[model samples]
Target: MGFWHTMVEVFPRFMPVLLEGAVIAVEVAAGALVVALAGGLVLALATLAPLRPVRFAARAYIEIIRGTPALTQLFIIYFGLADIGLGLPPLAAAIVGLGGNGAAYLAEVYRAGIAAIHRGQREAALSLGLVPTDVMRYVILPQATRIMVPPFCNFAIQLLLATSLVSAVAAPEIMFRARNLVMETYLSPHVYLLAAMLYLAVSIPMSHLTARLEQRLKRSR
Candidate 1:
């Protein structure tokens, strides 16, 4: 009864602030995803580029990003850039940090997806008199898209969770607000409890979508 009362009393204090924070988190995740998708596609293409330098550059970026911690990357994007006077706002930093980190992994996903398309498909498309662009547009990409969906969904879910790290750089996301509340009230349990619920609320749907896609992939296989 006492625990319930404390929870009820603390709810009003944390819920509103956390709700606002949750919205910011979602916005950051979604915006970062746009960056990842576009940049990842470009990086994947670079891997197949005819020039050795292009391939080397793309490989370097992927390896460096994938090799380092996401939080370290966030600090680089947020603080390191600031030291150079190219200071990005918190939201923008979150986008670039999360997006840049995610792009490395997504690039691998894109590369694998594109590669999974049998070389025969490309050859057949060329034999059909389709130009390279048309071969990619009409044949290769369409097939790769199907193969990519499950893994894409998985990475997106992971990226959504990664948004929590942005709060450390003062992005006003859910964890940021929760941390503030904990400090102010010193009621750690109630505050963190609510934060967990809030994160779970957002994450549950993403988890579901990823699972469904995986199941679909299996059945197709």
Candidate 2:
């Protein structure tokens, strides 16, 4: 049978599972994104910290996470943590792992973004009587965030795709459901093809939206 025929034959049975997985996928991505942003910001600030020890620790974490494979991180979170009697749900473990990993990458992005700003901008903000926090909030971060948007959006999409690895820990995300369908129907191409399409559906729009938002921000400035 053709791929379309296979889709028709399989979808009715699989759609429910696929839909559930999609929900899980969105939930995981959104949760991870939030964690990544919060953690990344803290790490970014630490990167500029005055204390040597704090700066060293932050940089070390970023390097370690960026250097390691996310799958290994997931295993450490899911399995290794269980060894210590800190048992988290598989889905929670996946979120923490993915979010923590993404945070490291994003912290570097934030660091670079902040660094790209002209030193004059910081001096000027200080001269204007703004406190350090006020300077970052009003001057430095506002512009740096604009510069960071494109790369950050790309990482967000990567995070979305990375959620697939959660399946290894029994998180029932889209790829996990796809694997189950493939096992039952033995229709690898169609099952995976549909999964890819669904991912593209989400990712493509997000990319475009980010682009449009960047443009709008530029115009407003």
Candidate 3:
């Protein structure tokens, strides 16, 4: 059948499966965002630590994660970790792998954002007799969060895209469902097109919202 013919006949059923995938994709993205933020904060602080060993370890992790392909990391976490009795479910493994990879890049982003703020802000906080943690919590982070949000939002989109790789390990996310639909229907083109549109539906709005957020943050400064 022709493309529209395929859409008319199959698209309705295809949509439910694609929507399921999109839900999983959002879960994976949200889960990884949490992990990335927490992990990035620790690594970013480590990179700025006074001790050389702390800084070296943080830098090494960043380099190693950045140097390797994310697919390899997923494989290692899903298959290789299983060999050591650390087997995680497919979704868990994907989240851990992607979040770990994201943390390295986010660490650099956080470090740059923190560094970009004026030193006077930190000094003024300190002058008020605020503790070091308080200074960072109140004075530094507010501004750094603004600078970090754009890149961080971009990273969130990248994380969403990367979730597609989890299918290799048998996670039944959108791409996985689409591939199954292709095999069942012999309609690869239509199946993939539907999936692409579904992804676009989520991503395009997110990008626009984040762009508006970035503008608001900049204006507030």
Candidate 4:
């Protein structure tokens, strides 16, 4: 049969399976984002810490993580961590691996957003007798957070796509599920096409949301 003929027959049959996989991917992304956002905040703060060593360590971490391929990091977490007596479950490993990778990029996003605010804003808050931490919490962060949102959502979308890499660790995400279905059904064209569409089903809506959010923030400013 021609490719289109086979796809017509197989696509509908695999749609549900592909969607189930996509759901898992979403879960992985959500879990990872919790880690990413928390860790990104710490890293962003470290970059501005009073201590020199703290800033160096944070910059080093961001550099090393951002420089490396995420797949390699995933392998280390999923496989290598066992060497240190820390054996993470596949799904847990996928979350940590993806989250760690995301934290570095998200740190940059937070950093840029925070830095974009005028220095005088921070100084003015300090003049009010606010401690450094209180200044960040009340003054800088409030405005900076608004700037961070659209970019953070964009990163979340990227993180969702990145979960496809979890298939390498057999994490049962969308790509992994689709690959198994393709092997079992021998419907590569249909399964893969459906898988791509499942991803688009996420990314397209998010892309529109990103644009709309950017417009809204611009107006609010």
Q: Compared with the true structure, what per-residue lDDT tens digits does model 3 show for residues 130-208?
A: 9988888888988889889999988898789888888888888999999999999898889999999988898899899
Ranking by TM-score: 4, 3, 1, 2
Task: Please give me the total number of clashing residue pairs in predicted model 3.
Answer: 0
What tens digits encode model 1's per-residue C-alpha lDDT throughout 83-145? Answer: 999999999999999998888889999999999999999999899899988898789888898
Candidate 4 least-lDDT 10 residues: 9-18
* Tens-digit per-residue lDDT, 11-101, candidate 2: 7777777878989989999899989998999999998999999999999999999999999999999999899999789889988999999
| TM-score list, all predictions | 0.94, 0.92, 0.95, 0.96
True lDDT of residue 18, candidate 3: 90
What is each predicted model's overall lDDT from 0 to 1?
0.90, 0.90, 0.91, 0.91
Task: Look at candidate 2 and give me any clashing residue pairs.
Answer: none
Instruction: Please say which candidate is ahead in lDDT: 2 or 3.
Output: 3
Candidate 3 achieves a global lDDT of 0.91
Give RMSD (Å) of candidate 3 vs. truth.
1.3
List candidate 1 segments past 4 Å from native: 216-221
Give the CA lDDT, 0 to 100, for residue 42 in model 2: 96
lDDT of 1: 0.90
Which candidate leads the pack in TM-score?
4
